[model samples]
Target chain A: MTRPTRPQSAPAEAATSATPVLELRGIRKSFGSNVVLDGIDLAVQAGEVVVLVGPSGCGKSTLLRCAIGLEQIDGGEVLLDGSVVSGAQRDQQARTRMGMVFQSYDLFPNMTVLDNVTLAPTLVRNADKAQAEERARALLARVGLAEKADAWPNTLSGGQQQRVAICRALAMDPEVLLLDEVTAALDPEMVHEVLQVVLELADEGLTMLIVTHEMSFARAIADRVVMLDGGVVVEEGGPDFFEHPQTERARAFLRTFEFHRVGR
Target chain B: MGAEFLFQGATIQRLLAGLGVTLRISLISVALSVPLGVVMGVLFTRKNRVLRAVLRVYLDFIRVMPQLVLLFLVFFGSASSLGLNFSGEVASIIVFTAWGAAELGDLVRAALEAIPQSQYDGAFALGLTSKQTFARVILPQALRSLLPPSVNLVTRIIKTTSLCMLIGVVEVVRVGQQIIDFNRFDYPMGALWTYATLALLYFVICWPLSLLSRWLEKRSSR
Candidate 1:
C-alpha cells in the first residue's frame, strides 16, 4: 500500500452489539424490465464505515434510496435492527432513525442553514425552538459553518452546502447515515472540503454507508468496502479488496478505475 | 367651463363617493377571493386525483364564462332559477369572488407545481410528513413564485369591479355616468371631463399595484 489507512474511529457500538444497524436481504429492483439491482444482500454493523464503490450505473445510488425507504425494492427487504422497513408507511420512522445525504446536497432553498437543520425537530419531534436552535448552532460549529447559521442555502458554496447537508442529517441524531455520492457533484477543489466533513463523522463513530467514486478516500476511510456490479454485490471486504479483487468483474472494474484514476 | 365643473365641490364629492364604492367592492371581493384562491392553488398541487379534477372543472367553468354574464346570472338570471336573495352589492361580491379565486388558484397551482421534486425529496428525507413538508418547504417556495402573479391578480380584480356598474351598484363607472348625464346639457363637454376623471381615478388605484408586481418580479427572479 502506498499510504497507510486511518485507524478505526467508529465508536464502541461494534464492541457491544452483534446486530447490524442496516441490513439488505435478497434485494431485487428493476425499472420496467431493465434490472437495476438483482438479488443482493448486505449488512452494515453499528459504527461500521462501509464504503460502496462501483463503476457508474452499478445501483449504488439506488441501494441508498432503497435503504432509506425513498425507493421501494422489487423483491428484497430493507431491515433496520432486523425489522422490515420496506413499506411506505414505515418511511417516516425509518427516515428518523437513519439519514441520507444526496450528491446534490438537496438543502431546503427557502430556509436558512440553521432552520434547515432544526426544521425536522421543531416539526416532527416537537423539539423546543430554543433547544433546537442551540443544538443547531453547535452542529454548525462542528461543520465549520457557525457564522453561516442565518444564511440561506443558495448563498453557500457547494462544499459549504454539502457540509451543511451532513450537519442537517446529523442534527437528527440518526443511528446510521447514508451518503449517496456526496462529493460527486462538487468542484474538484471543493471535494475534499465535503469529504473532510464525512471523515469527521466517521471518526465520531457514526455508522455510515457511503457510495463514492473517490477510490483514494474510500481506501482511507472504509472499514469494509462493498463492490457492486450489475445490481449485485460482486465482492465486499476490507480496503485490501481494491488491491486484490477475487472476481473477474471486480478485477476488471478496479483495473479501469486505477488506469483512469488520473483522468478522474 | 369643463375646468369649472372638474373642480366643482358637488362634482368632486360625487367622484370620491364613486371611488369609495369602488374600493369597498374590490376590498370585500379580495378578502373573499384571495383565501379561496390560495386554497385552490394548494389543493391543485396536491396528489389527490379527485380534488384536482373537481378544481379543474370549477376553474374551467368560471374561466370560460365572462364576468358580466356571471354578474347577470347571479343578480338577475339566477333570481328565479336559483332562488338566491341578495342585493346588487352582495351579488357583485359573489361573482367577483368566484372569478378572482379561479384566477388566483391557477396562479397558485402554477407556482406550486414549478417547485423542483428535489425540494420534496429533501424535505421528506428530513423525516417530515408530507403535510409538514408542504407547510414548511413547498409552501414557502410556492409563495415566492406566486407573489408577482398575485399582485397582478389584485390589480385585475380592482379593475373588474367596474363591471358591477351594469348591475346598478352605483360604483365608480356608473356614478361617473350619472355625473355626465346630470350635466350633459349645461356643461356641454361634461361627458368628456367626467369620463377622464374616472380614468384618472382608476389609474391612481391600479398604478401602485403594477409597480408592486414589477418589484416582486425582480425580487423573486433574483
Candidate 2:
C-alpha cells in the first residue's frame, strides 16, 4: 500500500455513529426465473468508501438499490445507522437518510440546476429557500460549476450533469451516499473530471458506496473493494485487490476492462 | 323570401338569449369537470387494488352508457324517482358536470401513469417523500400529457350540451328548432343559418384550447 505523505484527515461527522452507516445481511432478489442478489452480505462503516465492482448484470446496482430500499429484498435485512431499513423493522425515514445518484444523472430536466440540487433540502429537510440556494451554490462550486447554478440540466455537458447530480445527493446531507456507475455514462475524456470530484469527496471523508466500472477510481478512492458476480461477493479486500485479485472470477472480470495507466 | 324570417327584433333577441344559456352551461360544466377529471385521472393510477377496481368499473359504466341516456337518467329518471324539482336548466348543469368530471378524471389518471417510473425513482433517491416527490416532480411534468386529452374532452362536452334540448333547456340548438317550428313554410334557410351560427360559436370556444393542447404536446416532445 502506498502510504499517505500527510496525516489522514479524521472521519466525517456522519461516520461517528456506533452502528455501521449501512449493513445488508443475506440480501436475495430475483426477477421471476432470474436471480439477481443471491444472499449477498455487506457492511459499510461511516466515512468509508466502499466500491462494488463487477461485470454488467452482476447485480451491483441492484445491491445498492436494495441497500437504499429503492427495491424490496426478496429475503433478508438492510440496516442503516443501526436501525433496520427494510423488512419487519424497516423505517422509510431511515432509508431517506441515505442518498443515491444514478448512472444516467437523472436530473429533473424541467428544473434549473440550482433547483435540482436544492430540491430535497427545501422539500424534505424543510430548509428555507435562501438557505437551500446558498447550500446548492456551495455544493455546485465544490463540483467546479458555480456559474451553472441557474442553467437547465439539459444545457450542461454529461460530466457537468453528473457532477450536479452528485451535488444534489450531497444536498440532502445524507449519512451515506450511493453512486451507481456514476461515471460510466460520461465520455472517456470527461470521466476523470467527474471521478476527480468523487475522489475529493472521499478525501473529505464522506461515507460512500459507489458501484463502478472505472477500475482506477475503484483503486484510488475505495478504502475497501467489494467484488460481486452472479449475485454474490466473489471477493472483498483493499486497494491492492485491483492489482492482485484473488478469486478467478475477479481476475477474469478485471482482465476484460482496460484500466488507465497510473502513477507515471 | 318572407320578411318574418329576416333578422328582426324577436328572432335575433331569442338567438342571443339562447347563446347566453349555451355559454353558461358550457362554462359551468367545464369548471366542474376539469378539477373532477384531474382528481379521477390521478386516482386511477394509484396502487390500491380495491380503489382501482371500483374506479375502473365506474369509468366503464360512464364510457359505455350513451351521454344522452345518462342525461335522461339524471334529469328525467332520477329527478322524478327521487322527487327533486330542479328546473330543466339546473338539472342540465348537474348532469353535464358529472359527465365532464368522469371524463377529465380518466385523462388525469392516464397522464399520471404515462410518466416513466424512473422519474419517481430519481425523486425518491433525492430523499423527497413520496407525496413531495409526486407533487413537486410528477404532477408538473404530467401536465403536458394531460393538456391534449383535456382539450378534446372540452370540445366533446360543448357538443354534448346539444342534448339539453331533449330535456327542454332552450340552448341555441333548441332555439333553432323553435325558429324551424314557426318558419318552416316561408324559409327553411333561416334555421340552417341559425344552426350554422351555433356550430361556429362552438368552434370559436374550443379552437383555442385545441391550439393550446397542440402547443403543449410539441413542447413536451422537446
Candidate 3:
C-alpha cells in the first residue's frame, strides 16, 4: 500500500515575517455563561494550510466561524492581511475576502447549481453577469461538476452538493478559505470525494483554515497541525507532531483515533 | 318553480351587478392588504420589542373582534360618532383590508420563521448584506412557503364579502334575498332555488382558489 505525499511549500520558518492572510489574536468568545474560545492566537500565512483538530465541544468550529465574522466574538479581534476585520470594523466587504464551506453544504435550494455559484460574485462584487457565469463555469468544471450546473441543489448527491458548495465559496475569489468540518455529514464512502477537492486546492497553494475530525486526512493535508483542547491551543507543530506529540494532552487526544501508518 | 325566478325581470343581471360589487370590494382590498401585510410581516420578524408589541396589539384587536363588528364600527360608528361619512362599500373595504392584512401578516411571519437559520448564515457567509439576504435569499424562499396560505386567504376574503350585505351594501346575497322575497307566493320554491344558486355562485368563485392553493402546496412540498 502507498500514500500520497503532501506538496511542499515555502518553509514555515521563512514565512514568519510576511503578513498572514488571516489572523486571530487573543480571541475570546462565550455563549451565555459558558466560554467557548479563550484568548487564542493563530495565523495562516499566505498559501499555508492550517488544520484544527479537537474533540467535540472544543470550539474548533467556533474559531473558524469567528475568523469569517459569522459568530460575534465577545473580545479580541480578527485580522485580514494585518488590518482589523473584527468587531465594529467588520463589514460585508471585509467578509467577502474570506470564503467558508460548511458541513451541511448550505446551497440555496431555490437555485440551480450555476445560480448558486454565480449569486455571490454578481451580487456582492458587482461583477458582470456574463463574466461571472463564465468564471463560475470554470470553477464548477474544475471541481468535476460542470455537468451538474443546471441541476437543482436537491437533485444532487450529498458529495456532489458539497463539491458545488466548494465551488460556491471559490467563486468569491477569497483571499482565505475556511472549511468547517466540511465532511462531518458525509457517509464514509462519500468523504473521499470532498477531501480530494480540498487536497487539490491545497496543491494549488490556496490559503485555508480547516477544522476536521478525520485524523488521517488531517495528517495528510496539514502543513501545520494545531491541536485544540478545552478552548486553547494544546499543541502546534508540523505533521511530525502526529508521530511524536509533545504534550500528554495531545498524546492522549491522538490515542483516541486508531492510528494507521500512511506510506509505511 | 325551481329557479323560475332566476329568469324573471332582469334577475340574472341584478345578481351579476351585485356580484361585480362584491368582486370589486374583494379586489381592491386584496391589492391594498397584500403589500401592507408583506411589509408588516417583514417588520414582525425584526427583534424590536416595542414595534412588535404595538403590532401584536393591533393583530390581537383585529383577531378578537368579529368581522361583523368591524364592519359596523367602520360603517355606522364612524358616521355617527367620528362624523366621518363613509359609504357601506367603502367601510366594507376598510374592514376587510384590515382583516386580510392581519391574517396575511401572520402567515408571512410563520413562513419566514419556517426557514432554517442556516439559510441566513449561508447567505451572510457569502457576504450578502442583510437587505440583500432578505431580498435575494430569504424572501424568495419565504414566498414559496407562503403561497398556498395566501391563496387560501384570498378565498376567505371573497367568501367573507357576503357579510358586507348586512351593512346594506346589497351584494350577491342581498340581491338573492330580494329576488326570493319578490316571488315568495308566485314561485313557492323561490327561496330554495335562490339560496342554492347563491351557494353555487360562491362555489364557482372559491373552488378554483382552493384548487390553486392545493396545487401550490403540492409543488412546494416536492
TM-score, model 1 to reference: 0.92
Chain B alone, candidate 3, TM-score of: 0.97
What candidate 1 gets wrong by more than 4 Å, as runs, is A1-17, A258-264, B48-50, B83-85
Model 3 chain B: which ten-residue window has the lowest total lDDT? B1-10
Clashing pairs in 1: A11-A205
List the lowest-lDDT window of 10 residues for candidate 3 chain A: A1-10
TM-score of chain B of each: 0.95, 0.90, 0.97
- Interface Cα RMSD per model, in Å? 1.0, 1.4, 0.7
Between candidates 1 and 2, the DockQ winner: 1
Model 3, C-alpha of B143: deviation from truth (Å): 0.2
DockQ of candidate 3 is 0.82
Error of 3 at A57 (Å): 1.1
List, for all models, the DockQ compared with the true complex: 0.73, 0.50, 0.82
Off by over 4 Å in 3: A1-8, A259-264
The collision pairs in model 2 are B37-B104, B37-B105, B41-B105, B41-B109
- What is residue A133's positional error in candidate 3, in angstroms? 1.5
Writing each residue's lDDT as its tens digit, candidate 2 over A102-213 gives 9898898778999998888888778999999999999999889999999989899999999999999898888999999988888998898988888888878788999998
Chain B structural similarity as TM-score, candidate 1: 0.95
Clashing pairs in 3: none
Candidate with more favorable, higher lDDT: 1 or 3: 3
